[model samples]
Target: ILNFKNLEYFNMDFCTAFSNSFLQMSELMASLKYLSLSNSYLNGTILDQGLCELVYLQEVNIDRNNLSGSLPWCLANLTYLRLLDVSFNQLTENISSSPLMNLTYIEELWLSNNHFQISISLEPFFNHSKLKFFDGDIYAEIETSHSSLTPKFQLTSISLFGHGDSGIFPKFLYHQHDLEYVDLSHLNLTREFPNWLLEKNKKLKRLSLVNISLFGPFPLPIHCHKNLRVLDVSNNKLQGHIPIEIGEVLPNLVVLNVATNAFNGSIPSSFGNTWPWGCFYLEYLVLSNNSLQGQLFSKEFNLTKLKRLNLDGNHFIGDIPKTLSNCSALQGLYISDNNISGNIPTRLGNLSFLDAIMMPNNRLEGPIPSAFCQLRHLEILDLSRNNISGSLPSCSSPFNIRRVHLSKNMLQGPLLGDLSYNRLNSNIPDWMNRLPQLRYLILANNGLEGEMPLQLCWLNKLQLVDLSHNNLSGQIPHCLYNISFNYREDNHDLFDQDPQILYQLPQLQILYTNYHNHKYLTNFTTKQRLYTYEVQPLHSMSGLDLSCNKLIGEIPLQIGELSRIHTLNLSHNNLTGESPVTFSHMKQVESLDLSYNNLNGKIPPRLIELNALAVFSVAFNNLSGKTPDRVAQFGTFEEDSYEGNPFLCGQPLLKSCNENGP
Candidate 1:
């Protein structure tokens, strides 16, 4: 293709093989009017000279490449250039003072996500009268002040996130009337809600004001424009109740998120109200971390196309509505930490598209829904801290269940039986080994009996295993260290979302809850204290907790091999043995509790170098020794952390080390 001098259009986007050889092509394809090499694996500094020779080029997109260095000063020579997109590259240093200003024909310019160190003025950009899309920073200077400025272009889209100081809204926006899309996110703009921008740019289709300092009640206009598709005001300082006419006014809205705000009061029943057209086309509605209370069973919320509805961290009270089954297209429903009561609706299983059902920390009760087993695509099921009774649902079908949390619940008996939910009092079920995709399984504080199942060793993807406070009695399985996700370096495929579920949903967010990268939240019992971890922190965490159980045996030395393990608790058991010096091999362990055991040995001195150790306790043990040297995290421990062992002595403790004792 290099021989063809007539090549006018060259597109190699996402082509990893296309490298610096593209720079030489300019000699042959001088007539090239369009060139897009985005996401290509091109390395080294972007060529400063070659691109200018292609004077006929109208559009050039080389974004998301490894190209670095400052903006090419020669770019201004390409007066015929209509569009230029060099975003998401490693380009560093200051831009040329008058860069691309002479390109009067330029209509679109995207220079975001680069390390342009110097501040730029909007005066030069004013020369490009045809500008329709400008995303780079354009801080106003004395010459470009709004009162005297007269912009020649009418921008349809403007994105200025993390671009400039949080002064008043760019006053130049007052000159433009055709704006359709605007993103002022992550800017400390202390303006009052930017309702004036909404009033002026009525054609705005997408408005994002995330993490801004906007104050005062959200000014939701009574009459919403028909084209307003998305409105994200999350992570702001906004207060006051959400307008009651939100659903009725923003009828065409698709994504409405006001999460992490101070808004209080019950969610208006009008929130569930529909437009005159009968159905709502809304897809993602997130109102988490607000003070919104009251029942969720409003007649207005008949969103059939809804995918993700997150109403967590609120004070909402009332029964989990059975009418929620009407949301036939629902995928991820997170209503945890609310005062909602009532039994798990069996009808929820009918939504074959459902991926997660997180209803933890609620007042809901009754047996686990056996119909939930029918959801072949279910990835997460968290019903912990509730009064949910009965045993786990018995189903022989292969599943995609990765995380199941029934801890702190009233669930009783062994998880064994067929689909009929009949009692089969026995040991841990052998069928648990069949679910190879299982990563986190927590059933702590339940009354499960029988020896720790050896079949659980077959879970190759197991990362977090907790069976604490149970009636189980047996030596811990030694093969537990072989779970692939923890032991293997190439277990990336294990934690990934099921390929079948991904193929079925196709969209990046199946139900608008982006949990593909997020692991299920799990509580860790380290140092005799419970700590809750959400998704982000769970990715790097691996743990094993079998404390407060009746198991009687020596601690498995093989547990030391789990180098990726972050928390390991085996306290309150009747184990008898010397602490494995091999335990020092756990380099990444953050919290380790081996207290309340009949073990007899000196605390491993090698453990002192465990730099990541934040919590370490071995109280109530038969151990006797001078505590490990108090350095780093060791200096922060209290005397109670090493109490109940009268023989052990240290600096923080009242008892001192014996003279000349090793």
Candidate 2:
């Protein structure tokens, strides 16, 4: 209100909107030093006429708004401005000649995620002696002026992401000694590693130079800086062995990611050793997609604080070290695509906090350790593409389990399994009735032969059922529609006390900041094409694939009750009777395949109402009648969709319905 002439701070952040009189009222509060309207739905070229007139303003934050146009030249009147955050807006301007050049007293500036054309050269801000933080755009480019000017300010944090090849690193960084955080990721530097940056900034806490086209060996700082906590140099061309004395150099590191590089040689043993006075605090160690070889771990290794360890896509060999069991805080373990051979270390069960175990495409053998049942918090278990054999052990504790991938193995026996692409020749496990929380049952490409068990209907939570490419046969269960393939109910409350839930624990968040980015993928054939579905998409997907099986019976009309189902494939079966007219209720059906069957009678013309249908095929059947009307999605259907059914005639077919006497 204009009556509050002494108002020093006015914050409307997160508000729906500001009244028309609010701006006029704000202008009267000449003593206002702080004004924050971030995410307040303010539009147009910002309130430059009113806010910029407040010459005594010290801080202005209008981020996350739809404000557009160039930075107002009137902003130069606020000579005492100490902070300016215009990030996440549609504003466009050139930083070289903007009003920002006059705000010499500015201490912090945020211009990220905008259309600001920023020059890679830092000479524009050389006069801001008090500038402590500078965040710029990802589209910054090198300036034509190749001046080697030194800045007067000593920034504690500076981030400038560039597009394409930006020539070389900014020479002005050479004069900075007070920097604590620096990120030049995705800049396409195409230059050698800047080891000198580390040598100069002794107090640096976090350094990220990812995907910057950095080449040559990664040399460490000669002097140890205990303050440094995170170092990410992933997705580069850096080669050579990691420094052996890294543990002594940066002893307090919480994250060390060097994945997707050309680095060769075994992991340095120094990583296992503790500091002279205290233990190493390392938590995340990622070295995937490299040429590193040799045994994974040494006997004397002792990294008790370790959580997630990724060594995938490498040449590493030897048994998984039993010493890994000592990492009681461990959660995720990824060692796939390697030459590692031997039984899975049973001692891994000692890690009670473990959640995900990815070890596919390896030479592992033997049955899954029964000790794994101790992991009550486990969510994902993937051991596909191995020599694992014997029956699946049952101990029952991981009630939170969601996904299981044990395909491509020699495992055999009647047990609760995801034993697809294996040598399992027994009947589909009836014991599956006991697991009430089961969601995905993938047993395709196996020798399992038997009648469809009625017990499957009891698993109401089931979302995806894949039994294709097997010897299974029986009548289609009418009760199959009882399964609610709807979106999974939120079960996060079950793991409320678990530290593996990143958001619940602040300490674990620091260690698993990238944990949510990890995807849980599975292969499913749909519309004659195999698709790999990731976690988010797979959650919304509901399909039943029983093609390439020996199933026989009439198509169940009750299946149409599954209105949310996205895919339904029952082709290559001995099904009889007319196509279910109730199929028109499947509003979400994308791929419907009942081809290669002995069905007869008129094709349900009501099926044309399925607007969401992208793939439709009833070909190679003994049906007769005109095809569904050539309209909507059916208009895109070709002759192959109606071929092999000689009596069937429509626009897509060469034979006319009049001539065929449909």
Q: How accurate locally is residue 522 in candidate 1, as Cα lDDT from 0 to 100?
A: 60
Could you tally the backbone clashes for each prediction?
3, 0
In candidate 1, how many clashes are counted?
Answer: 3
User: Which lDDT tens digits does candidate 1 get at residues 338-386?
Assistant: 8889888898988777888888789999988888878887877777677
Error of 2 at 201 (Å): 0.7
After superposition on all C-alphas, the RMSD of every candidate to the true structure, in Å, is: 5.6, 4.5
lDDT of 2 by residue, 154-260 (tens): 99998887677777888788899999988888888888888788899998988888788999998888887788877888889999998777888888887788888
Q: What is the lDDT of residue 500 in candidate 2?
A: 16
How many Å off is the CA of 78 in candidate 2?
A: 2.2
**TM-score per model over all chains:** 0.83, 0.88
Q: Clashes in candidate 2: how many?
A: 0
lDDT of 1 at 440: 66
Q: Give the Cα-based TM-score of candidate 2 against the true structure.
A: 0.88
Candidate that scores best on lDDT: 2
> Which predicted model would earn the best TM-score?
2
Instruction: Determine the C-alpha RMSD for candidate 1 after optimal superposition of all C-alphas.
Output: 5.6
